[model samples]
Target chain A: MPAAPVIAIVGATGAVGVELLGSLARRNFPLSQLRLLASKRSAGREMRFRGGTLIVEELTENSFDGVDIALFSAGATISRRFAPIAAAAGARVVDNSSAFRMDPAVPLVVPEVNADTMQGDEAIIANPNCVAAIAGVALAPLHRAFPIRRLQMATYQAASGAGAEAMQELRDGTAAELRGEAFEPKVMPHPYAFNIFSHNADIDPQTGYNGEESKVIAELRRIFDLPQLPVGVTCIRVPILRAHGMAISIEFDQVVDPQVARDLLSDAPGLRLVDDWAGNHFPMPSEATGQEDVLVGRIRTDLGDPSGRTLTLFVVGDQLLKGAAQNAVQIAESLLPAH
Target chain B: MPAAPVIAIVGATGAVGVELLGSLARRNFPLSQLRLLASKRSAGREMRFRGGTLIVEELTENSFDGVDIALFSAGATISRRFAPIAAAAGARVVDNSSAFRMDPAVPLVVPEVNADTMQGDEAIIANPNCVAAIAGVALAPLHRAFPIRRLQMATYQAASGAGAEAMQELRDGTAAELRGEAFEPKVMPHPYAFNIFSHNADIDPQTGYNGEESKVIAELRRIFDLPQLPVGVTCIRVPILRAHGMAISIEFDQVVDPQVARDLLSDAPGLRLVDDWAGNHFPMPSEATGQEDVLVGRIRTDLGDPSGRTLTLFVVGDQLLKGAAQNAVQIAESLLPAH
Candidate 1:
């Protein structure tokens, strides 16, 4: 039997970190040994994976010894500090943070969209934002079906995307509000129960786009190499738990049909068409929160734009699944051809 | 004083109908006698007004007799069926339904924005969609500053826009899901909690826009008298209760400054400038839900579309108040300049 691959997971105690562990077990990623790393506070925590329990160790300069693949989800600060160290120790890093994404040398990737770009990595590959990763999969096939000109999108993001504490904040805040008790918001920037917050970040006094939204737009533009494409976006965080939804309107260079776009998406690997509007069936967070495939539905002619080429759709996906862990694993799956 | 005006309320038990009553009371509309009219199911309900109880009676041919002003909050079907009857009975009808909004002869009125043309003598005055009402408040000031040539808006509508039962649907459906109960959705076309749905109504074969969204765009154009202006819109229903928020991008003939726009809106009536991002104080649904004025905020220059005169903003308002009831009552307040 062949020796299993060595896998190391940084930020193992975080939200995306937990999802990474599950995706490993679900995909059954060949593993000779699993190493868990986290901040000093969370380093000693014990977690269950499949049948065995794993103890997390504090991530440090020398933590990547004998590691073949490192998954970084500790956040941009931790990733910025530790990712280069891991890559220098000869481990290929699948970084699920924004730290290295815009670096000219770093390849921002969604495996299904750009597996080829990950091949010549300087050992550290970037995972795009959750919304971008899911959108890329759906857009890749359609961009191939019809050359595009511009895109406009609005997102309904989930609480989980903010982190574990934010999710707890939503549940606790809502429960407390129900009980008529004071709910002091700790993790989230604002009340997280029944409200939506705009994400175009406070205009940077320089760049207009919020940090999060700018990353998605810039990464999509870079990933698709469409430097001049017009992308208009408004990102909103909602009171949902896991899945994020985007209302997308596309204006392609050539005219496109709803059926044709639907067929292209149906044939795409990373997407599932849940669009039977007549039956009140379409992409929904409740259904897509744990699913690997991005749900794209409500496809129709863009009434706002003329020329049959414009389309409007509702796209939804689990922020943890396709948005984070699953995409990282799929990238690792690309490097090692053997299942 | 001369004989006070006799007033009637149609669909007295509905969400907007209730607000209409409260707004009338709060604003102190002088009424010598009041008649509450509703369907047979809600006809016998009793509503208190100004320390007095008014019994809701069945809306029939004689319901509007001797009444000088009738406020209609029923659905479009009822409004379509009875608005003319009330007008023929010598009553000025303020119909809060889509049935008369697009009617060429019927004037669409937003007193603060279009009080000049609110001749109101068609005997039937129409109300725009809730989202449109809020959007109008934000856009009117900007249009005056720049003469808007085109508009692109995406709305985050609340459940209250669907009516009292839909608000109940969100509350009940959400509670049901929490209790692990099977949710039986009835009020909305789809489930109303923890989910978002599209507002593009079933499209007419001849026109591409949905019934609801089309009404908004058409009504906006008619009220603004920008008949040739291009208005592209996509409306989404979110899991909020009473306020509706819209993300709008406009192209103006002249340059738009976020600061100057704020100054103009600061002076504009029935509008509150809530765009202070430094304080993290943009208008949100929770803040706007119960407020009379539509809160306009998140003001910024459009980063894309090199034309540079474009501005983007988020506007939120209480669908029940400014969007429906208070708006109709405000028109009535306009008729009562002495108040």
Candidate 2:
């Protein structure tokens, strides 16, 4: 790789794709040239980037010919078809899709948690499910200090995880709801105005876990390197636009003090402590939207665990940025040679 | 007491009070007379009840005259001041506030769970917290069958739990948000439009549990007749109008089959089953709003517990009805001679 890499952002017209552009520009990433690629429908669309307009081009097999780093934010089908081609063309791929996440040969990474796991020579690095990525940032520090034995999570996911259209669905449906007008949902299977439902992902009849919940469970285990780590999560979509929030209970191998865990999280990279007992303040999605750092708070010993080995925390992160686009960009940054 | 009791509703203009009137009407409650009482501000306001408009009378020391049963839905301050007065005035009081909930002498009842705890002669009966009441209904049958060993909950509470004004605040703020206008929240501590926040209840510095969480913990233990039940709860307010939803993990004394739990819940009173894995349908706040039964679903073995003794459920209930008004009316019904 050269001192400045030629970067390409796949699905540039989508939600995370737009954020990917902002992330690269905001970080002032060392990119020799930038290419924006999307579907045929979105091709030729102009998007503002770094005080200039970049035209979206239709993605083709030859799109990554001279690109050194390719960020994939399109869905899994597109990633499955094109990521390997990009990789074979000598471009390192950071895929923000489930296409290669669970593959044993690929490293599913939350850069803050497992950047070193990236061998640098791998064809593609996988970004985890949004819940897994957000939770991993907050859980990794404590899990490292005291090995985690069990995990429980209840998520308040946002519409952005479903993609850009769902975010617009939330806004439009909410406006219609306020006007006492009927809205037939087009993107979401259920109502999206001032309401919440279990994640729209199809449920696995055998396990009773939705597709999103299953992905979070498997991806978290991979990211933590705890192959057999038990995880239970309920994924629900609230009416918010972008950020996701969750209540997580982490059980360690032995009794752990909440204050000790709080101290550890305070200094952890990619985390900002928002826990304030006196102010009745903790991680909130309204504050987490558009922010790079995951907000971690409500840190306390789990009252559900009699042995006192568990701690409960509330975490919030931008589903588009930290959970997808920003993390994918960070993985590309790890390929740089300055270090 | 007379064959047809004289029922008095305290704070009749409030959210739960309005629902209390509807609950009584829908059940065709036997009553000789109905008295509607409220604060001086709401006094003289006309509210439709049963087919006629009842004029709200200012609640005073003498408001309970000739009243056989009094249902209180005002805040704790009013309950603390007026509940005993009504009791002393020869009325059996069912209070929907926290004033007397933790009192050893007061029976904190979810009628479906612990109706027998209230002796007909008791001066006052306390209703469990909204979350506790809704959870108690779904859990009582399961706990009776398997005996719960541990409990953990993460709540998606509604604006109605705070009261009528908060609900209006949510609608107003959300409308302003849709219009791209500014709205300073008047009732909630945080922005209420398309946002979620930790329950605005004051935090208990020592335990890091907010007031709502503490109430659920204490009240659930009281209702379940388990003094030492380890309970952990996180209460959050989503932007929904009335119904509250929660994801709960219940650890039982032994390995229990999800099918067995499903059978028990299907037959349980005050609950409606909504678990449909294939159709991707589960309990949702939109469907639970104004519904009589607490919708329970998403029942499965908790993968986080390797012991196989834990099950997770998603529960949703109307915050104003079962959470407060309906439970209070049910307690009053248990006082009737036939019951």
Candidate 3:
């Protein structure tokens, strides 16, 4: 790899795409050139980068010709068809879609949790699902200390998980509802005005779990190297804009002190402890919206477990930052020769 | 007991108090007279009921003298001060606050789940916390069949639980947020616009569980007649208006098929099965806000328990209806001699 690689961001007009630019600029990533690539409709758009304007080029077979590092944030179908081609064009591909997350050859990575899984020569590095990436940062510390026996999670997801269009829909729909006007949802399957619903991902006929829940389960297992880890999750989309929150219950093999778990999490990478009991303050989507750290708090022994073998926690993270763009950027950073 | 009893609403100007009037009129309970009572500030306020307007009277020691039944929903402080006085005035009391819920003499009741716990001789009947009443109706049927070993719940609570003021705060805060204006949160401790936070109830220092959570655990145990039933819960306040949703994971003594659980919930009263797998439609707060029955769906085998001994469900109930006023009214109805 060259001293300063040419970095390319695919799907550069979407929510995570915009955040990718912000993360790269804020981190002061060493890059010789930056290329913004998107669909034809957004091809001529100009995006600000490093105090300069970069035009978004239409993604084509020739888009990755001289690119050294390509970050793909488009949908799975786009990644499935183009990631290999980008890799064949000599770019190290980091895909932020579910297309290759579960593939045996792909190293599903949450850099803080499983950076060692990445081999520099791999054709593609798949980013874990947003929930998996956020929750893994908080759970990894405790699981490493005591080994999680079982995991159960309930998510309060935001509209940005659906994309920039869904975020605008939430804003528009909420405004109309406040004015006592009816607004039809065109992006989200359900109304997004002060409402909550099951995730819009297609539900599995046999398992009864939605596609989003399944991805979190599979990706967390791969990220933790626990192939058969039992995980149960419910994903619900709330009316918030860009942050996701989750309530997680983890059962350990033996009794573990909550304070010990807290101590471990307080020292974990990419995590911040926000547990304040007297103040009645913990992780909230409002506080985590633009922050890179996953806010972890509300740590307590699980009252549901009489054996003192379980702990419950609340975690919040920016869906577009640490959950996607920042994580993908971190993986690319780890692949640099200096690391 | 009279066939047509005289009824009184102690907190008639508040959210649940107004709903109490609606429930009485909608259910067409046999009432000869209705008394609307509130604090000094709200006294003399006119409220509509059964196509006629009733003047709100200031609650006093003499308020319940000729009243056959009293429904109290002002707050825990008001209930703690006046519930016994009202009961002494020969009015059957159905208290909606947390004052007398755990008292051995007061029968905490969810009519469909455990009305048998209410003996006609009791002076005060305790209406459970919103989450307990809503969850109990759905969990009762399953626990009766499979005998629940443990339970874990994460709640998406609405603003109405805090009172009429908090609901308005949500609306005003959201409107201000949409317009890019700053709004101070006077009713809620935290920002209420398009955000989620830990339950605002005071947290217990020892357990790190908030008062709301503790009430749910203790009340659910009492309602189920399982004094030591292990229950783990996290109560969160969401941005919705009037309905509360919970994701519950239940562990049974043995492996319980999801289909069997579905059959039991389907036949259960006070519940409507809303699990439509193909439609990706489940219980949503918008659909549950004004409904009488609790919407139950997303029933599946919990993968968190590889033993197949656990099942998960998503339940949504109107916070003011099934959770508070309607439940209190149902208790008063059961107390009538017509039974």
Candidate 4:
């Protein structure tokens, strides 16, 4: 890239965008210049970076003129329209939308799982879905030891996955619920306070799987390089703010002992074992809110199968951190030469 | 039975006890008298019934002297202590606790599933756990169409299952969360506001299954009369007030069509089909709360199995109504001749 890359954060006013700024600062990503870009509505907004104020400018084709790296977290339509322009302008684009993830030409990178697959010479790199990123990081080590044959997942997702407005909606809805007042849903389709439902994403008419669940399955397969791996996912949105939790069951080609899996997960990168059976503490969303490492626990043999080839566990990870912003920052860090 | 049996309600001040009173009144059970029984602390409390006030009496050995039917929801300790005394005093006891559920001597009854197994003359009848009861009502219809060979379940349980104090703890916890204050949990082990956790039950170290999960598995096996059927369950407590939801995957010996399952569930007793695919609405805890029937939807073939023998669905039910009090009252009603 440049001697020290000039970076631009598209959609800098959104949830993941705000987190991207914090992640770059917290991780101390080496950069000579930082640019904040957003829609016209947030054009005049000021955000602080490295103890200095930076004014957000309206994103346009000319916004990537001198930028060496652009991190895109805007909606898919915006990314699809602007990512190519940024790439053509000689800036490397790391897109956080689902638009380019399934493209054979694009490399979906988690950094922890498949950093080598990302070609530095490529103009754009795609980030996997939040659920996929979290699950891929936790499942990679185990899959390396014993290839996973099948996976069944049930997700308890938080409001941040939808966007910052959805998070505010959850807060306002819950406050109204506490006040015994009716709060009509604006961001989400249903009442989100003190209630849980299947993911609000559109369902596949033939399969009945929602968009999030389908994305998770496809992204996990692509990230793991297991094209034929069978995955069944049911995604539900719970009334939480930031972190996402999943209950997963995996069947391996060979019989795997839970202790062996636990030992492997304990030493795995981007993961921490929080399984304290006696304490009745496992991976909960509240404890995983601001943590970088995904918390994993409740490692046990699946009682449904007697063949010892199945294992079940629960995992939680910060959706804004490793699920999006931190992962994107890590990919950027992987591109730079070792200091 | 005597003309209009004299009914006694044990633990008349608890969460399920309150629902039991409403259910009895709503169903208009033919009763000559209603006796409210609770601990000495609540003995003097007066509750309204049939537009008249009844004084709560202390639950002593002599509380069942003239009672024809006794409904016990106090707890296992209280049920174990006094249910036998009531039965020996010539009253049929319907216990809503884990105390006698697995006892071969006591018939575990869910009127919708296995009411025929219950003999009216039996001195004691045990109700299934709330999770088991809800799952039973939803799964019985499907299992009958095609025998289920394997089952996997993940539950989203509510606060009322833990009792009235725990429900209040949730309410207060939410209010404290809204105020940005620290809430030290008094009824639950963890902070339950906008958080989810593994069921707060003692884990079986050898199996890694908690008590509630184990009870659900055992109760399902007993109710279905499939002694060797395998069930894998992970029970979680969510931050909802009343209803419980479950995501279930079933593997059958033969292929099952989703349309068949939907039609059967719609016609089945104690279940309401809420699968609105076009509207993107399925069973939700908020809709299931205070509803008599368990809501079932999101039925589709399991993508993990190519054999076409597996299906997955979602369900929600009011824990108090069909899960606990209503089912117990139905058992009591089964004892009386037609009005």
Candidate 5:
């Protein structure tokens, strides 16, 4: 790989894409050249980069001709069609889509959890689901301390998980509600203004689990290398603009003290311990937005189990950053040589 | 008690107070007179009930002199000061505050779960917390079937739980956020617009459980008549306006089937089964608002436990109705002779 790689950002106009630009610039990614690529609709859009404006070009098979690293944040269909082509064209692809996450060949990675999974030779690296990535970052240290026997998660996800259009829908629908006007949801399936609903992803009839929940469950299992780890998840979309929050109850094989767990999380990379019991302040999505670390708090022993083998906690992280763009960028950084 | 009781509504200008008026009217509650009462500031305010406007009176020792039944939706301090005075004046009080819920003498009643606990002799009947009330209505039938071993709950509570001012704060804060203006939070400690936070209730320093969580746990135990029942609760305040949603994982003594639980809940009173697993539609605050019945859905086995004794479900209910006002009204209705 070149000392300074030529980087291409797919879905350059989407929410995660915008965050990718910011994260790359803030982290000072060593990129000799940066190409912004999107659909035909956003082709000529100019996005601010390191110190100047970069014109977005329409994504095509030839978009990765000279690119050494391609970061993809488009939907599954776009990534499915273009990621392989970009990889075949000699660019290392780090995808934020769910297309190749469960594939055995593609390493689904959370840099803080299992960065070593991605060797320099892999053509493509898959980023875990936003919820799974956040949970992985917060739970990895605890899982290492006490093997997680089971996990129960309920997610309060934001509009951005559905993409930039859904974020716009949340804003516009909320504005319309404030104005006392009727809002017919255009991007999201439900009226998202000051409302909460089950994730819009298709539900598996037999299991009654939505696609997003399934992705989080499977991705976390894969990331933790616990193939048989049992996980139950409920994914809900709240009216939040960008960040995601999750309430998690974990059962471990052995007793785990809350203070020890807090200490482990405090020292864990990519995690910020926000457990302030006296202040009644815990992880909140509003404070976690645009922040890199996953904020974790409300760490206490599960009240239902007197055996002291279970704990409950809450976590919040910016979906656009740690969940999507920052995770993919970290994977790309792992592929590069020492700075 | 009088044949046609004079009903007084304390805190008649609040959110739950408004719902109490609507519920009483919709249910065609028998009353010789309806008295609206609020603080001194709102004494002259008018509220429409049963076809005419009733002038709000300042709640005092004399407000309940001729009243036979009083519904209190005021805060705990107001309930603490006025509830006993009302009872002393020959009015039976059904309080919607947390003041007397844990009092051994005050029967904490969810009509569908434990109406018999209040034998029409108790001077004051206590309404369960909003989250606990919703859960009680949905879980009572299932607990009867399999005998619940433990319960784990995560609540997506609405702003109305904090009262009318908090609801207003949510709306104005959201509007300010949409307008790109600064919002100074008055009712809530956090910026409630597009944000989810741990329930603003005071946290127990030793346990890390907030007051809302503690109430739900304690109230559920009392309502279920299981003094030693194990319940783990996490209460979160979401951006929703009126209704509350809960994700519950239940462990039973015996293995239970999803169909059996569905059948039990479908036939249960004060519950509407909305389990449309194939449609990816479940209970949501938007649909549950103003609805009397708790919407229960997403019934499935807990994937984490292979013992087949655990099930997971979701429930949504209007906090002002099923969670508060309607429950108080139902208790008052039970006090009447069979008609």
Candidate 6:
């Protein structure tokens, strides 16, 4: 094998960061040495790796001193603070936050869709939102067949995308409800055990877009470079812990056949077509949680518009894997020229 | 009020049936005499209504004797075999299953939306599918505003819609997962606790439509009498036990406005506006489980479809209440030519 890449994982103790490590090990990414970085609160902890244990270190500007590649899964604030430092330190950085996504200089990429556009000398590649990342994995093939004119999407997001605390909150809240025990809400603002919450969190009140919804729209447009592309989206937080599902309605410039969409997605990169309505086996969260590929199903030509130019389907993917971490690693592996 | 219309509740032992009795009492639907009927398996059971014990008798040809109005929340098969018997016995039957929803002679009623359509001459009234029924509460006002040309809907249904056993399976399956006990699937064909199953029951293997999706499409057309009105729907069974949520996208012939749609629904009977993203106060299953009105939110113009003729929104309602029993009872309350 070729010499391994020296990779550093920021926020290694967080949900997506942990998955980033697992995905690398599972795919056997050629890694020379793994540097795990977290906040002071989680520094000095030990976590599992390929076949050994790695010690977590506190993250600081100087921490990127010798790293070859830095993957950031921390929150936007942390990424905003450290990503530039890591990039300035001569490391290629793949950011899994909205921080640098809309920046004209930083390339937002899903390798299979925009790999070539990612390899610019600026060295910071932004990851799209999990919903867009997963949707793009399936839609890219169709867009190849018939360039999309407009897209309508409603997402059912998992809690893990928020952070480890959100994941714990869902697991513990649900566990508490089952035991008929009182569970104080700390991870999320509301009770989230069996209930599905609106994904529009912290409304801007002025623009009528919440933090989550705004991120989805902005990141999606930036990633696809369809600034004028008509898009309508409503983000919902469902009770699932790790996978996100989306009901996507697409309107293409030309007529669409359900079989054609299914055929394209059947072997699309990073996508699994599980659309056998005969077996009741369309993609679902419970089945897609630990999976790496985005699952697409309920494939059909939507006659709702009788003009019949739309194809509506459902998509499920592990929010932490393909949505965030794995995509980041995959991008680093393919390092687009625009990054 | 003139003496409460003599009322009867059939299949009063099921989940919807139980909710029907409570709703009738809570809504103070006029009731001079109450008769309860159930299958032989549940015969002689007792239920409390209006501070008195009501005996459930075995449903027979004479079950509706002396009944002025009969509300049926039984399964479709039971309704198909018995609703006509009750109507023949001089009682007006309002059925909450799919049995008569598409029958040309029966008026599928959502009193708040299409009360004027009920002439009471059919003797047997049908309640639309829970999601379809609740959707009308929103669509009727919008249809009046722009006239619906097409509908694209994705349903997140609760287990309670299947029956009491399905509800138990969800609770039991979840509890088992919590207790570290391996659970055997019985009531549900698959795992139910944290999982969202397909809205379909038993795929036909030939025609891909599930029983639930087919009913939603057929019932909507019959209720709207626009047999050609384009409808594309996907029914998903979620872990929610009693409420159903739909992410609906609609196309209209006239220009559509999101704020205008919100205002129309705010005062529309059987519909509640829950669009406050600032408060994170949108429609939800746990909140809508016992509520009568369908909760609507995330109201937005379909920016992706720039012709300004499309709008999208999210709606939730109690499958057992507004979607089923309560709708049936409301129909019986207003269907009689003379109350």
Per-model DockQ: 0.45, 0.87, 0.92, 0.81, 0.81, 0.60
Best by lDDT: 3
**Could you list the chain B TM-scores for each candidate?**
0.96, 0.99, 0.99, 0.98, 0.98, 0.95
lDDT of each: 0.82, 0.93, 0.94, 0.92, 0.91, 0.82
* Two-way lDDT contest, 2 vs 3, winner: 3
DockQ for the candidate 4 complex?
Answer: 0.81
Interface RMSD of 2: 0.7
Candidate 4 chain A weakest ten by summed lDDT: A330-339
- Identify the superior model by TM-score, candidate 1 or candidate 2: 2
Over B242-298, each residue of candidate 6 has an lDDT whose tens digit, in order, gives: 888988878889887678888888978888888876677778886887888788887
Looking at candidate 5 chain B, the ten consecutive residues that score lowest on lDDT are B273-282
Which candidate ranks first by DockQ, i.e. highest?
3
lDDT by residue for model 6 over A12-66, one digit each (tens)? 9999889989988887788788999999999999999976999999999899987
Single out the weakest 10-residue window by summed lDDT for candidate 5 chain A: A330-339
Clashes of 5: 0
Cα lDDT tens digits for candidate 1, B1-339:
124688899998999989988998988888888889999998778899899999999999888889888999998999988989998998888899988887778888887678777753568888777877778888888777679887777788888888899887887887776666899888787776677777626754444356777777888888898876767776778888888888887878888777898798889989998865565667788788778999987677775455677777878899999999999988776665353
Off by over 4 Å in 4: none
* Quality of model 5 by C-alpha lDDT: 0.91
Residue runs of model 1 more than 4 Å from their true location after superposition: A1-3, A200-202, A306-309, A337-339, B1-3, B203-209, B337-339
Please tell me which model should have the higher lDDT, number 1 or number 4: 4
Which scores greater on DockQ, model 3 or model 6? 3
lDDT of 2 at B1: 75
Query: Which CAPRI tier for candidate 1?
Result: acceptable
Whichever of 3 and 4 has more lDDT, that candidate is 3
lDDT of 6 at A247: 80
lDDT by residue (A1-339, candidate 3, tens digit) is 787899999999999999999999999889999999999999999999988999999999899998999999998999999999999999999999989998999999988888889877998999889999999999998988899888999999999999999999999999999999999999999998989999989999999999999999988888999999999999999999999999999999999888999999999999999998988889999999899999999999999999999999999999999999999999989878978
- Classify candidate 2 by CAPRI docking class: high
Candidate 2 displacement at residue B81 in angstroms: 1.4
